[model samples]
Target: MLEPIGQATAAAQNIWGDATQWGVGTGVGTVSGGFEFPSVEEIDAVLSSWRARQASIAQRGNTLELMVSSLTQQPAEDDATTGYIATWAQSLTQLRDQHRSMLEYIEDYIKKLEAAKQAKQAGEAENEAAVQKTAGDLAQ
Candidate 1:
């Protein structure tokens, strides 16, 4: 639901990156400011919420399918109304699949971002430790 807002925020960050390349001679250049980076926990929570949404969608789809089946069995007289309901049989399923795919992609990306952030932090820590050891060795 609110995933599109998050995506738009990410898009803005990327757009800000482009400004750095064009502004050496120019007087006033765009500065990086006011960017809110979401924590891993926030991302995880969002992913979980989306998963729950997916489950609800699946369950609802199943229920709707059953209802539609019952309607078809009864054989309605109105072709126009029946035809519209029939279209939903395909549309609803497609909507579910598309939503699932999108959520999966977002969850995967968030997980990967978390992994990369952890790896970077670990590497920085190792470097600091190595520098401290070198300084201690020199002091002795």
Candidate 2:
């Protein structure tokens, strides 16, 4: 029950990391030296993959919620039942941690994407100005 939830959460985190890297770019070193921009197609592919992962995680979460509700209603009297409940709680905690981390990763990636877009726009504007200047000089 909870085990599946934990696994799904971990999968979500991995998917988030991969999608963010593909969308915004990733590197070590200085920002100016190591920066790399992925093509629009690559970013779109990654976004699609992330959406699929999100759907899977939501399904797992729904299943886990149902199991948890069922378990909660059950009368736990034996040692085995107690142990099972303990294990389920642990798995739930792990799942929550993974989900939180994935959300943070998504937020960070969004910020990175916005910065990249702004930089790209500025560069295009500069190039356009340069071309205009060159054309004017040629006309003279």
Candidate 3:
């Protein structure tokens, strides 16, 4: 019934609220002003968490799709019932799309995190090389 769909919509809103809590990194690899970039391992862990969240969104989307399918497949006996079913289906479809959007957002964030991790590692290697070069010059 429409009541159950209403409950599902509330659940989706909670999931979206949780998604907004994630802090997108501020200028990945920016070393100015002493911004401490996360370590590669730390980034990896964050990426893992985001991936898990993405999976959860995907699962919720699947559920919404199933509900929509069930509502749409039912044979409505009257104009009133048809109208109610149509409304429920429309709402569920929109919620499912929102879930898909969240999944995409999380995926994009994961890619950015991976890129930042790589950049940080590269910077560390460059710093180490410079230190060794300076030390060698001093030894001569």
Candidate 4:
């Protein structure tokens, strides 16, 4: 009975080891199948697309900031002379609120992008460390 149990355990271990090996092989094959270096033209196209998007966002934000600043800086037109002054005041308030909201959104987006970039960098570092460890083990 003990001998049979030992054989079963060994069989189970062998099955588990084989499964692990196959899983690793499948993962490597999948990654290699998908991996390709982008041509310089493709790289430039992607970079230009991103740069244009960045520039557009920056220009919009700057325009909003400038409008808000200009509105806030101007002296109030005398209310007694014209109710246009009151209307201007109300419009200025709305503009300020919109600008503030947009600025907040831009700030949040920047922070999120930074966090994602940092996470990618950290993951690459971890992968490098793992590769180095495997290389050292193989050397020994």
Q: Name the best candidate (by lDDT).
A: 3
Q: Model 4, range 5-78, lDDT digits (tens) per residue?
A: 57777798666643333322222224454222223344455545655666676677677666556545445556
C-alpha RMSD for every candidate:
10.1, 10.0, 10.2, 18.0
Clashing pairs in 1: none
Whole-model lDDT, model 4: 0.57
lDDT of 4 at 136: 100
- TM-score per candidate, chains pooled: 0.50, 0.58, 0.70, 0.45
| Candidate 3 all-Cα RMSD | 10.2
lDDT of 3 by residue, 57-117 (tens): 7888877877877884657589888888888888888888888888888888888788877
For candidate 2, give the lDDT of residue 132: 100
Q: Candidates 2 and 4: which is better by TM-score?
A: 2
Whole-model lDDT per candidate: 0.59, 0.63, 0.76, 0.57
Local lDDT at 55 for model 4: 65
**Number of the top-ranking candidate, with TM-score as the measure:** 3
Clashes per candidate (backbone, < 3 Å): 0, 0, 0, 0
Q: Is candidate 2 or candidate 3 better by lDDT?
A: 3
Model 2 pairs in collision: none
> How do the residues 68-134 of candidate 1 rate in per-residue lDDT, one tens digit apiece?
5654553555988778767866676676677667657766765655554465456567879999999
Error (Å) of candidate 4 at residue 42 is: 13
Order of candidate numbers by lDDT, starting with the best: 3, 2, 1, 4
Q: Residue 24 in model 2: shift from native, Å? A: 14
* Ten-residue stretch with the least lDDT total in model 3: 27-36
